[model samples]
Target: MTTPRLTPHAYVLAVPDLTRTTAYFEHVLGFSRLWNDGDNWQALGRDGVRVMLGRCPDAIPPAELGDHSYFAYVEVSDLDGFHAEIAAKGALLGFPPRDQPWGRREMAVATPDGHRMMFANPIRA
Candidate 1:
């Protein structure tokens, strides 16, 4: 038997406003629609990242989760270049890209709902 290798397929989110959240991801993060089911569900992707949204109008907004609302730390290359690209697209990032002591270069972006995604790349010597 072989050990299984794992990779992230998507991150699921419960959102109170699906349309607004979807638009933020598309317009700000440069993701494109992968699939959608009118008002109930949607999937968006960019590069190799995929995010799935489920409409949950009665659920507590992600903003209410505080530290528990962090979305994901996506792996990406060209950390600074990606920062410039998304920032120009009007991404409301929480922090600029910086070299981390953990040997990665990283940045962060947040949705109006207050959920956050961190993007990182391994630092090479």
Candidate 2:
């Protein structure tokens, strides 16, 4: 018997301010708002990625979580183009895309709340 693989369809993030957090995903990262439940919850999507944001004013902000705040690792094509586009849009970049010894090119960025995400593309020969 083989264990089934898990495919993540959406990520839920708690943010202090839903409106502001959604704005970062929308205005900066180029995600489109898919749904919303007034001030409590909102969903944003880009490409095939979906992110659900819930307002949580009392919880510790992601900025305080350090490495624990990282929530997503996404694989993408044309990473250099994506990097250039996001950089021009003022995305808070972690590092420019670079080839790694592990046979991939990777880049990283942090959301306004400090939730980190890594994007990668396979380095082709």
Q: Compose the digit string of candidate 2's lDDT tens values, residues 47-92.
A: 9999999999999999899889989989988899989989998899
Q: How many Å off is the CA of 22 in candidate 1? A: 0.8
My TM-score estimates for the predictions, one after another, are: 0.93, 0.93
Which candidate leads the pack in lDDT?
2
lDDT of 1 by residue, 1-125 (tens): 99999987999999989999999999888899999998999999998889999999999888889888897988887888889988998888889999989899889889978888899999988
The TM-score that candidate 1 achieves is 0.93
Q: Model 2's lDDT to the true fold?
A: 0.92
Q: Relative to the unseen true structure, what is the C-alpha lDDT of residue 41 in candidate 2, on a scale of 0 to 100?
A: 96
